[model samples]
Target: MLAHVTVTGRVQGVGFRYSAQQQAAQHNLTGWVQNKADGSVELKVEGPEQKVDRFLEEMKAGFTQFIKVKQIDVDRFNKDEGYKQFSIK
Candidate 1:
């Protein structure tokens, strides 16, 4: 499955992308995380459903101190981007 996640709050310049990369690697997920122009963090992840869910949970729970995660918008990704590994983009 593929998901596009937009995380809002104090998510930039707080190691959120790096933490997300680590979590994605741990879950064997392939995708990319990037800071948006609007001060949000955007993530595109593709992997097993359970792994993807776990990765998201880990990111939210582990970075609570640095990130508030005010809002999270998750959507289905239809394109076949074929990401090989998780990355900070």
Candidate 2:
């Protein structure tokens, strides 16, 4: 499955992307996370269904702490499904 998470907030820096990479790696997920020009971080994670759930949980885990997740738009497993490993794109 593929899960695309677009998080908005003060998520550009403060180790958000790195932490996301860590979380994704921990779940053995794949895809990427990148700092958007609009001061948000967009992440794409692909893995097993259970792992994807955990991935989302892990993603929201740091919200309002390391970063404020004002908004989240998730597109769940609608398309691609072949990501080797997570990355910062």
Best model per TM-score: 1
- TM-score for each prediction? 0.88, 0.87
Cα lDDT of candidate 1 equals 0.84
Which residue ranges in model 2 land beyond 4 Å of their true spot? Answer: none
In candidate 1, which residue pairs get closer than 3 Å at backbone N, Cα or C atoms, i.e. clash? none
Which lDDT values do the candidates have, in the order given?
0.84, 0.80
lDDT of 2 by residue, 1-89 (tens): 88878998778868898888888888788899999888888888888888888878766767337676667789886566677778888
Q: Write down the RMSD of all candidates, one decimal each.
A: 1.7, 1.8
Structure candidate 2, residue pairs in collision: none
Off by over 4 Å in 1: 62-64, 77-80
Error of 1 at 22 (Å): 0.4
